[model samples]
Target chain A: MPSSCDEKIPRIEHHQNNSDVSITICGYWSLNSRERLRLLRRWESLVLQWKDVLRFEIKCDESLVWDSSLVVFLRNANRDLSVNGGQVVFLDLPAGLNKLLNLADEGQKRNKEQKQDPPSDGFLSMEALLKPLDFLGALVISFLNLVRGRSVMRWRDFFASARNCSASALPIVTLISFLTGVTMAFVGSVQLEKFNATIYVADLVSLAMVREMGALMVAIIMAGRTGAAFAAELGNMNLNEEIDSLETFGICSVSFLVLPRTLALFVMTPLLTIYADIVGILGGLLVGTLVMGFSALHYLEQTQSALTDMWEVYSGVSKSLFFGLIIGFVGCYKGVFSGRDSASLGKSVTSAVVISVTLIIIADAFFETAFSLLELR
Target chain B: MNVSGRDDIVIRVESLDLAYGNHLVLKNISFEVRRGDCLVVMGGSGCGKSTLLKSMVGLLAPLRGKIIIDRDELWLNGDKKRKETLKKLGVLFQNGALWSSMTVFENVAMPLEIFTDLGVKEVENLVDYKLALVGLAGAGNFYPSELSGGMRKRAGLARAMAMDPEILFLDEPSAGLDPITSKRLDDLINELKESLGISFVVVTHELASIFDIADDSIFLDSESKEILAHGNPKDLLKENTLTKVRSFLERKTVNNS
Candidate 1:
């Protein structure tokens, strides 16, 4: 199909001597895409007519400038010929081309051997489904060891994780908390002003920040930031066999790696939530004074009066503790059990963030429902 | 200095000095690897043998020196020319750093796909041939985690050979293999060298592998931070020129026996 140019077109001459046949490939075999497609089509048709040929001999033109494309085409042709009880023989071929043909033949033979024994199918069985329960049991034992001061938890790693989870996360936490408080105040003031009840906007912002949004927003951010970091760090260690090395030294990897990370998160998340609550209140104070035209002192007084019962703030801070545990445990579990490869490590990090955020939301819902029921009682 | 007439001189490293930060690793090192020659770089555990190999393969730049491959100065060339020169060379890293994400077939096909305009079917056939060369023909579909350590090395070797490079660099090919597997790998290297006329730069501490495959060798001393000796392994053993080299080789021999 290629237009004949300066490059020579390959020609096949067939000669029959008794029951033997010889096919001579003449001219340049430097076939590109178009030429190769045409050549294969022609060869396929020619192979059907040469059924009587018992032995096939191939001879190439000496001045041929060919690539691997030629070799592959010939190999495919030979495969078709061999299936029909004909054997192809190379005559006067260059040493490199001959070696390539031999290598292809060897590969074909090995492929046949592999076909006899199929590879294992990577599927989770019933036993694999229950493996998480075993992981959980080991985690509980590690926690008990920590309680008794017998765990192999590294103080350095724990403090490093704590600093990363708390101080390093301050910027994003402050931004999200301030923005959430401002938006809530603005929306509530608009609705309240219609009823000449704009002064109650402070009460609305205080209740929302202390009871729900502050803790929930902080938890979601930590799940994305800290949870993904935990998964990636542990996944890298798992890929490098560092976990195995620790186990080889008689150290429990769960205690040494997971406990420190989880404890750091558990201790830090509530502190971060409380910080976010203060920042959120300040943001609401700004919106109340500047936008809603309320006095700063009046807004603060209204907020204090609405939060007379400390149960609202306590419930929100308590929810953060549970959210922190869920994020840390899920992240470490995904990381420690990650597959021993880079791709699986990436997948583990992704799943860790997703699962932690989802679990945090579910926990938040349960707490919100429980607190409302308690208020009614 | 007139290496132009000597077509056999494939690689020439002149007055090479390598450093990581201010700590010098190898100093004033010079070596030449000829065509069809297997140059084994030998040293103790912390010696700069692997670092020197990395410099030669363009993974690291020497602190001060020139590396000429086929008369083209590797470091002096621009990006395009450097890539052109690198296309003629293949490297197998320590621990067989195959992409764990891809299957073995895709790993071998990667170089061909990037460098050549060959179609998919042609690439598949070439990958098959390369895998077969390294005795991994049946492992095309298997991921790196699915294969044993030796198989991973072989798969890495197949990927390195996908381009049919003129110079092949292997770092610790026999590091994590059984005796029979190591021997088989050695045999494959020898066969490829003889059949394809490829010059090999192998970095290793295995005496058995060195004796079996090295046509020439250089010994780097950790204390001196320089090449202690250079010659054929057998001749170096017989000459006993450097006490450190002799002791290292003798210690390995004793361990083997």
Candidate 2:
């Protein structure tokens, strides 16, 4: 069947005179026609055999029916044959083919004529290493300007950021924190039950929530939700030249835009951490009451005792403030410096969330060690 | 450097050179925008006409030379002083660049609010007048997203005109607009020039608008990264010393016509 199909393809007949060749093509060459690649291969082999040919003329039949595929093949063939100072000239071709072939030639010429602006280096370029530090310097300047009461920020923008990272973020934080607490209690209860100390599940759940899980979970949540939003919003602003307008007006973009957003996250992260801590403890209390058959008051006593050292709670809350700043900072930095296209803007948003989450974990480790060394743990 | 008593010189660029990273753009561009003169910066695409405008308007720091706006060196001064110098300049960016978040009224009123001690009623009155001046009398309540491209450009011009700066640097004012719409914008620019005596430093390739608004003009060449010609567009057309400048003007007109 493939052999039968090949015989029905367009025919190529050539008449050669010394270094010059004229090839005549006849029949249909639509894009979907089968065995077109075979015909192209045949054409290629013929040109390869006539490597010394100085000029090849292409003559299309009066009844020829072809498409862009033929034009592309001819374009490449023309280029190949012309590589050794030879020329490919189309003879008696249809008007459309002539124009299309000319257009291909003209486009190449045009491309060569114009100086190309190199595409932006992708996400992991060397600039990425120093971007955080550059952003940090700008952030410090903005912070100082804010301290001096010279920052340009809208009160409502801060409220909007707070609302997004806090009020709207509450439901997800609740679900995650509660499930985490329940999971810890279930695991700890099973292990402690073997030794007849299932009551220690309450201590384990409350201690984890107070010392680490609470802040870390909230930071990761905001990183996905709030961090992504900040990146997208500011990236869009950069594309629209809103940032440039502000700068040309002599208004510092970091002071006007970044400060309000980062400050909102800084102020709200700890508050959300506390709320999550309380709800998570309630989740453990439920597990202790139902699964372990302990009174709710007894579970509360255990959690309270476990959290007796206020610094354990303070340790998590303090970390959250830094967590929030990191999220906002990374998002705004990625956005304000985003490239001038939708694809780059999207990449900026994704990287903002990723960087925020990664930085949050690393900073958490740093703070954890610092607290332990200072005897606050 | 010394304009002396020449009130004619509003903007003076002395051998300005600009770059992006290390790629050179404009080189040794020296020109003066006289008071009340509509100076058009005309060139082929990618010729750094807009880059030159950006440098003059305090957006890009030049690699060499100075941009003196009304006798104050723009880049040499403290940022506070640069900002003080900037206040004398209003810019209408390509694509209008209106704060999409703000209504047209608020967009125009913002500069007045931030840079002045005007009362609310005064700001409202001034915004209304500016809007009316651009023929967007009832469009003040609309956001930039709600307006057509031509109206957006008009709103942007209104904002640029809000501060009533000495020089208005417009980067491609007629871009992406229909011929009729662009003509209206050009006419509006002429109206403002006649009424308020504002100096215009417009960067555009629109031949019609160039002829319509430009009292003086400079042409930048991409190959040399320098100004190829400087004069009135009308005068330059008659005696084009270089074929490139002649073709730049003629080809655009031919294509449009």
- Report the number of the highest-TM-score candidate: 2
What is the DockQ of the complex in model 1? Answer: 0.02
Q: TM-score of chain A for each candidate?
A: 0.89, 0.88
Please, what are the lDDT tens digits per residue for candidate 1 over residues A251-316? 577887888888899999999999999899988999999987889999999999999988879889
| Candidate 1 backbone collisions, by pair | none
* Segments of candidate 2 deviating more than 4 angstroms: A1-9, A17-20, A27-32, A52-74, A82-103, A113-131, B1-6, B252-257
Q: Candidate 2, residues B1-257: lDDT per residue as tens digits?
A: 22456567998999999998778898899999888889999988989988888888888899999999988999998778998899888899899899877899998998888778999999999999999999999999999999999999899899998988878989999999999999999998898888888889999999999999999999998879998999999999998868789888887322211
Docking class of 2: acceptable
* Chain B, candidate 2: TM-score: 0.95
**Every model's Cα RMSD, please?**
21.3, 4.0
Fnat per candidate: 0.00, 0.46
Off by over 4 Å in 1: A1-6, A15-21, A31-33, A48-55, A111-129, A373-377, B1-257
**Poorest 10 consecutive residues by lDDT, candidate 2 chain A:** A1-10
